[model samples]
Target: AFVAALIAGEKAAFHEWEAAPYFEGCLPVEVMAERGPETLRHGPLKPFGLTDPHAPERKPYAVVQLRQDNKLGTLFNMVGFQTKLKHGEQLRVFRTIPGLQHAEFARLGGVHRNTFLNSPKLLDASLRLAAMPRLRFSGQITGCEGYVESAAIGLLAGRFAAAERLGEPIALPPATTAHGALLNHITGGHVDAIEAGPRSFQPMNVNFGLFPPLAEGIRRAGAARTLAKKQALSARALGDLEIWIGRHPAAAAE
Candidate 1:
């Protein structure tokens, strides 16, 4: 839904809305922006002096607007005139009008500077640096895209690390389990390696794809059904984890 803003704003996706936004309601932002900065503000955002032209209606110098973009769309994003301008520029230019001059930034404008390593080239199955087995990484830094994906990596890293410290021959979670899928993605998915401080890792949350499906293909169901599936998987995983722990507890009381 917000991808249009994300791209148009360049590094300023969220901040593009500091003032009123442009209209990308029917067209692509890239296409809209090509029409010129004011074109969008006037068209999509044209403050038609319509709200109350006779009542000292304050017309917007120009407008930045937003519109619904998807079928199941419950979200909206700013359209055209995306920029890489400084934070001050947005406040000054966007805030130049009547309604928005004092409009506070809702999401704030900013930039994204992403980095990654060639995980396949440096780490082993447990996410330990092959050259420094004592260290492990989890979360987004490991290269899983979403928040849930990252948390799954953290869970597995903890399990594998605990088992290793206990001096017990370790066994992986059943490949047909939630914990197992997460571990599988991290130990050998799309991650590269961290060349700098091992502490420079990212963060994330968890979800179903991280788990193996239920016996009857339950996860594909709608909202209520998916929620039910997650609850069941959590209970099953916790019980299995306890068993694994009993046989090979963490040596350091972690």
Candidate 2:
């Protein structure tokens, strides 16, 4: 009942779509709700195959799911809650979820115009053009999503090219590091769709899910669970990254 009221009260504003093309595939949740209140219930919030143990006799009116954002499982994204809601509004609205009453968000969801390649199908481990090794790709064009992520790819590409020119072999960065995790996604970390039509790969920013999973015994939630997990992942990434940098004398010097 509270959830329904929150959604009902929420209002979103947008510039006229006539001014710019809005891809039908990524319509905001509130926009879909405008079609009819039940539209969302039939679509993203349909309650089927799920029964709450605490209230087995009661059927839920709606449901929401979260997707793991990184390999470490430290972050998750709301399954179908993309919006134009102001940041403060988003926190208030989303925090109303049963299990997320006190949830901490690493990044709030938003929509944007993004350009990226289906890199998993096209690029090699070194970000080199598979069909034409004479050329290399970097940054957002290569499918990395954020400023930090794009800059990291550019740095890696420059290093790879310099190593080749000097007749020295440079090892790929350890997948545990932020740079390696982002690069891995560009090259082959993403699985390809079997349908063989348009690719399902989407542009993504660096997050914990991209890195290799943490060792066992670090997966439970207690007080400060989210913060502790992120700290552990960051520490591991830095350690692995330093070791990788040490392997290349030229890279280390620079």
Candidate 3:
């Protein structure tokens, strides 16, 4: 009943909201709900790995996980609960979770409109604004997706700035490494598809597709081929990353 109500709940902006496109990676809960009754169950709410202590024999159909919002652990936030429902509706809906019947929210959920830059066109190799080298950009604002990717960019930016301050050569990470692959993607890897226009360079999560292929003779036979290929890539990436790190001994000190 709770899931059904959430699915049927009145969203704050019914008309204008429908016209705006949603990023595939962060689709709203109600938007997912509209796909089918079981879409949410299979996607965000899937209960494949978790084992309930009190009901070990019976598998859970769905699960909702809350995350820590602060360092003190006194505040918790729902993990994938982004929504546009009214405050009253949000409280009524979220309180339906098993252990959260009496849950008190420190902050009711809300949505924000986010804007990001087209980094490839606007930023240089070291992530400085091309037209204004005095400024540098990193993280999602520069178009790299996810926490890890954003942090990697931040680390690179810091290193580049430090190298400039110390009068050292700023060595870019090798394209084979994860950091390099992502940096390359945001800088120049993804060319806009003429037909798709701006959508061609849609935000992306790091994956093997972004990495350059393995060496010529590293092929494996039959069932082992796929896993073997991945292993080769991982090994190569790590080795290249080590070499890149070694070149920046000044960065190693910090």
Query: What is the clash count for each candidate, in the order shown?
Result: 15, 4, 0
lDDT of 1 by residue, 108-170 (tens): 343333344456556787788889888888776765555566676777788788889998656
TM-score of each: 0.45, 0.54, 0.81
Q: Name the runs in model 2 displaced over 4 angstroms.
A: 1-112, 193-199, 247-254
lDDT of 2 by residue, 31-96 (tens): 677777787777777898789899898998888878898999989888877676677777887787
Q: How close is candidate 3 to the true structure, as a TM-score?
A: 0.81
Model 3 residue 30 lDDT?
74
Off by over 4 Å in 1: 1-85, 92-108, 131-135, 145-166, 171-179, 190-205, 218-228, 247-254
Give residue 250's lDDT in candidate 1 (0 to 100): 65
Local lDDT at 230 for model 2: 86
Q: Give the TM-score of candidate 2.
A: 0.54
lDDT of 3 at 35: 85
